[model samples]
Target: MKMTRIFVAALAALGLSGIAWASTAGQREAEHFHWHNAGPFGTFDREAVQRGLQIYQEVCSSCHSLDLIHFRNLGEAGGPFESAEFPNANDNAIVMQIAAGYMIEDGPDDAGDMFERPGVPSDAFPSPFANPQQARGSNGGALPPDLSLIIKARHHGQDYVHSLLLGFNEEVPADVHVAPGKHYNPYFPGGVIAMAPPLFEGSVTYADGTEATMEQMSEDIVTFLTWASDPHMEARKQMGVMVLLYLFIFAILVYIAYRQIWAKVKH
Candidate 1:
């Protein structure tokens, strides 16, 4: 009984410590947004994803890099560039054209010098800067992080992304000090962000003619980022459904067999 009491006291202390730690983490609660890619049966919107891609290419791509994504991923099944004519994403003409637009660094030649060539469908998205120093140098000494897995990296994931993008330009509190190059965004931790207001009312012209409101852009970009973070999420959810159905049916069959076997027995 004494040991149990001690254990309980220890747990209470640990819980209090956890609360203190959470308070010190500096994370502000993000505003919630309805995501089509959320929940069990949720699927990505092709047009929204495509529009998000356009936004990334036109604006975010100037500083942020999506190092993990390849051009061909757009044309893959369930992706934005899905094409009935070209099932094989690697061979998709649109993907090839997009990749060809960028010049990638190739291997050293016979003279031991690197060469540049047009990128291919399989090539990863190229970084905006050559190195970390260059990236930071160009951006007022703030390194723009790669957006490849940002959706997974951030807490509250999708909601956080949407809020941060749309929460800019708010009135700064008297106590809060925003740096010269920084901007005020309540959704960001500590209520400040190095990135300026990226999304505007008329930022990029949507290809599908969707109104380019701040909220719409924010939602679209978050969808694309979520998909980029976990391209196989939909497939995994589908497989999970199949497995559950199989197990449920198997359990029913087993229960029926048990009843039949026990019926012939005495209790």
Candidate 2:
């Protein structure tokens, strides 16, 4: 009898927890957006990726860190800044120029002291905050996640990121209570986010003269991040296609040989 009562109480508690979770966990589904790199034959749009890089430098870099990326990656084949003339990423002048813009920290000389130096193609991107504690302290106790693999990290990653960027709602729903320093985004779980709306119109003047609309910026940044997450996607897809074609031809040849060998021996 005691075991039965305990079971019943536990079930009731679970039911109440489920109900509470259902109430607060209503998040809008991410809207789908057509990507240039969606299909097997798809390739990333270089222009959009370049623009996205600009957006990251101008805005996102202030909070988020792309810890996994290096400046040399920009000059690699199929990268946003790839140039036919520069076969080696380290030797690419444009990449070198971009790297030079950032200051990097280097280690101890004979004097045994750390020092700052100009960034190089081989250097990993610098974090805006020195540590996690500093990052959290600046952003109301929320650490801005590294954007390096963000596209691959989230569910429905591409769409979710794009929608979340555009999903911030100024008019809060009556039932939802937004806490101090938090913003309402329907796409975010629990419908609340610590990072406020980051993109705005005219956030950055595009060098290529593209209008910096909120939607455009969101799409561009997502594209850049997608590339960052999978820099070798195009090469991988190409290899897959070649392998499939080779297998198909090999299978056909084997079938032909089998038919020839069994011509006189009928089962």
Candidate 3:
């Protein structure tokens, strides 16, 4: 009973550091933010969102909450991920699957008696505690934030996520309190955040045998957050491509028109 209580207390403490704290990605060191320089999947695989999603589920999701997103949106992030398995994800179903970890009450809705989480699209995932005060009292006053649009709302978008994931460093003083865990960065929008550095060098062992270095993991996770920030990435990419195609066609027509108009003149 004692051990069970301790474990429960620990989780409750972690939960107390409720979601709401966020650090801007671009706010980190200039070099690290270069993850943006990696370019799109064509330039560098931004599609690692699956990999990043895996990282978020394995590490960050336990404490943070993406209350705004539904489990079904993962696979739909890009045109479907090519592989059947993501390193951290058991099956391709990771996208549509909900976290089975904690369950809380969400009050009555259309279903009448109330619903359970990770609830279907029809339900909202319940918080670990009834309210923020409960969370803060246990968590040393930290609150996690909704991660749905973090990438978009912040500057440099995806680049920022990449930098922040790998940027946690205790030696930097800003992150001293996090020790082996969370850290602080002067660049984070709020100037301080409760999240510890969840990813570290060789922290996770991938099933497919990729190096588990911090940089790789950071890149992967940022990709996922980028997608989560905008579930319609594929739609945006398609729109960009169409716009470029239209501009190219328009340019050709304009050139033709110019030649016709200038045909009678010679220099």
Candidate 4:
């Protein structure tokens, strides 16, 4: 059939493309992100997420932005944003800063200016770049992609990122030619991405009294990134339940309808 031929052609195309990526992506499974205890890996850890957010604010925010993520998402990780503002610099000064652009004032009137300055709310996280060009220039023209949805894009994302951070540099075969400013990594979309390893051994200090080893820090950051990308995990789960319930109900109705229509016309 025509449809069968089309399906075969599509499969062939997919195979060729995947092969091309394999040559370029050169990504390995062991050294890149492979979390032993995260949602996709094992289970979600609320405490690890909380710590990851703290680390993100202090360190990674300088380089990355969770523009699609809102300030309120912190609630899922046991941080309900105690105050009305974000990244609050002080107890009294409410104008919280972000890696992205400054927060534009927007809220209900008669709320009576709770803080000295306006804040970024849970509905939004600002973009650091004025535009895409500026963003590319800032990061050696690599164009730091918005990380708010990175977890969804990455393969075994949490694990891959964690592994990369834990010094999972790749071995370029002696015959392969690697251009300058490009690092060979098996975990990147292109086996040779411009992104150098971001995390290193003992790169951060933990307030939870945990050792700031490469493994711990990488895992923590990945957790935060995952939550940032998918803040509504609980909501999504709820919706899934509703969907399943609706399907069950619909099936029952259809069965009843079928029985009634055929009952009077017994063959």
Best by lDDT: 2
Question: Higher-TM-score candidate among 1 and 2?
Answer: 2
| Model 2 agreement with the true structure over 1-267: per-residue lDDT tens digits | 864564444433222212212322587878899999886677899999999999999999999999999999999988998998999999999899999999998998789999999999999889999999999999999999999999977777799899999988557899999998999999998889999899888999999999889889999999999999988778766765665566568779999999999997968
Count clashes in each candidate, considering only residues at least 3 apart in sequence or on different chains: 0, 0, 18, 14
lDDT of 4 by residue, 54-112 (tens): 67766676667777766545533323233444344233122234312344445445776
**In model 2, what are the clashing residue pairs, if there are any?**
none
> Which tens-of-lDDT digit does each residue in 1-267 have in candidate 3?
864564444433322222444544435443445543232222225446556666776777666667776544443434235334553232335433553444646669876887655434233334454566766665667876667788766665565566666555634554334344345765565445666667878776665577878888887777666666665644544555555556568779999999999997988
The candidate maximizing TM-score is: 2
Among all windows of 10 consecutive residues in model 4, the one with the lowest summed lDDT is 15-24
| Native-to-model Cα distance after best TM-score fit, residue 82 in candidate 1, in Å | 1.5
Candidate 1, residues 1-267: lDDT per residue as tens digits?
A: 864564444433222212212421555687777888776567888788888888999989999999999988988877788899999998999899989999999889999999999989899999999999999999899999999999978877898889889888678899889889988888888987889999999899998899999989988888888888877667766765665566568779999999999999985
lDDT of 2: 0.86
Error of 2 at 11 (Å): 44
By TM-score, is 2 or 3 better? 2
Q: lDDT values of the candidates?
A: 0.83, 0.86, 0.57, 0.59
Error of 3 at 31 (Å): 2.2
Candidate 2 minimal-lDDT segment of 10 residues: 14-23
